[model samples]
Target: MISKLNLENILFLDIETVPETAHYSDLDPTKQALWDAKSRYQRKEEYSAEEFYDRAGIWAEFGKIVCISVGYIKMEGEVRQFRVTSFYGDEVKILNDFKTLLNTHYQEQKYLLCAHNGKEFDFPYIARRMIIHHIELPNKLDLFGKKPWEVPHLDTLELWKFGDYKTYTSLKLLTNVLGIPSPKDDIDGSEVYDVYYKTKEIERIVVYCEKDTIAVAQIFLRLRGDQLLQEHEIIHV
Candidate 1:
């Protein structure tokens, strides 16, 4: 199925998010209560709401995107090359820049957005944040009345599932099994909050995000039984 689609038409991407505030105490009393109630089921007796606050970034309501890195394949002198770029900093600006990129370059039926576990996490999270910022939904991301078949989003995780809904696979694990370079070499998702709030090194996070985006593209190529890209073939813009 992947071989039937044009790889050049797909926009491969990934996003990094952090808690809206550095600490749980930073939220107002009402919001603190809401976070506790919202996360009670997942936390249970294992940890207090404050203890689990580090994970707030997983929930769109309590998080903001710090970086959204995207990549695509192009041809250069009969050789396939991959190019990547990132939008970082303020959540609103990051989202706005991503939306503009989508509208400007990929606003066609043939263009598809691809990411790892994107259907459940990256895709919905971006849309919710855009709504919170009062930004109009980009054509590719908006799925209001579209039929299920019309959604132009591709998920590497879903493709790997192959109709087995009970199993779960992390991108790191899949990439490892497929022999793609590890994207988690610098930092894993668990430490993103600390890296953002305490260290204030967003550039580091953006680099990590771009690595994941590149890995997603490479994994897709592996799935299609194609050659993995050589390091020299990757261009960071």
Candidate 2:
């Protein structure tokens, strides 16, 4: 049970991704054939394997992570004030800043990094990029292939399993079921790449990332016993 676990030292994190476009067309013959087949489906308004690469590259390019919003609640007197700090910047710089914060500020803290669907996507994506940028990853994120429950990592998605492997749920769906108000408005996951390309407004992306982090935190509180964030854990960039 999370109650048996210490909650005071936990940190929440979320990241945004776009398609990978660096020399996408330079695929080997076999991959090129596969790409061509997938492109045919995309032309037919069906799924596109190429879209996956394209999307990843898009995020890799103009997708400035812009903000890494963090939330934590510290006990304050009779009231708890939620503190949310949004670290913002270009992809390279922002990632570097996050690494510094994780190492310097969050290192000594016995806190768990929480996120939604972090196991399948967000965690690995961030780790790979950090490696590419030559930045050291926090110990929390280093648990890549470990069993779901074995590592110190806590994924709300995995928790949602509740010992049921067949019950797959999305953050949006869980929030709705739990009555957690959705913070999304201007942009969504699909529009993220387009918004960055059209307006180059990293704020929108940042806000989206903020909402995701909040959703993860909300899920954590919900699972912990219907307790919403107590203010200090809410950081506004």
Candidate 3:
């Protein structure tokens, strides 16, 4: 089925997020207590909610998106070019710009949004964040009442699973095993919070995020038995 789909019809995406605040103490008393309850199960007895704050970005309510990088295959004659761009800076602006992209360009019934583990992470995170900011969901992200088959999104992680849902695969590990170039040569997910909050190195995270977007595209091609994209074929805009 993957081989039958048009590459240009899919938008490959990745997002970088950080905790809503730099520290647990930055939250109001109500939010702090709520966070404590929210993270209690994940924290178990090993770590307190304060210690677990670094991972708050993983939850939509506790985090804000810092970057959203998207890529798509552009076919010009015999050339296959992968064009990448990002929406970053203010959280609301990021969501608004992304919504514009979806509404203006990829709103067709045939289009899809793809990510490494998008179904589990990127896709829903973006949706929840958009709702939090009072932005209307673009057709592709609006999955409120659609049937399962009516959904138009793809996850490289789920594709690789092939019906085995027991093991979770990271994008880095999947790229390594699939022979695609690793996108984690720089900072990883763990350091995104520090990089965005402490260093304010948004461009650095944008580059990393774009690489992941390209990697997701490459994985989709690989799954369809196509050649991997060459270095010269990927463009940043």
Candidate 1, residues 1-237: lDDT per residue as tens digits? Answer: 899999899999999998999999999999999999999999999999999999999999999999999999998668888999999999999999999999999999999999999999999999999999999999998999999999999999999999989988998999999999999999999989989999999889999999999999999999999999899999999
What lDDT score is found at residue 225 in candidate 3?
99
lDDT of 3 at 199: 94
Candidate 1: deviation at residue 190, Å?
0.3
Question: What's each prediction's TM-score?
Answer: 0.99, 0.79, 0.99
- The 10-residue segment of model 1 with minimum total lDDT is 75-84
lDDT of the candidates, in the order given: 0.95, 0.68, 0.94
Model 3: residues with Cα > 4 Å off, grouped in runs: none
Candidate 1's displacement at residue 128, Å, is 0.3
**Winning model by lDDT:** 1
Q: How close is candidate 2 to the true structure, as a TM-score?
A: 0.79
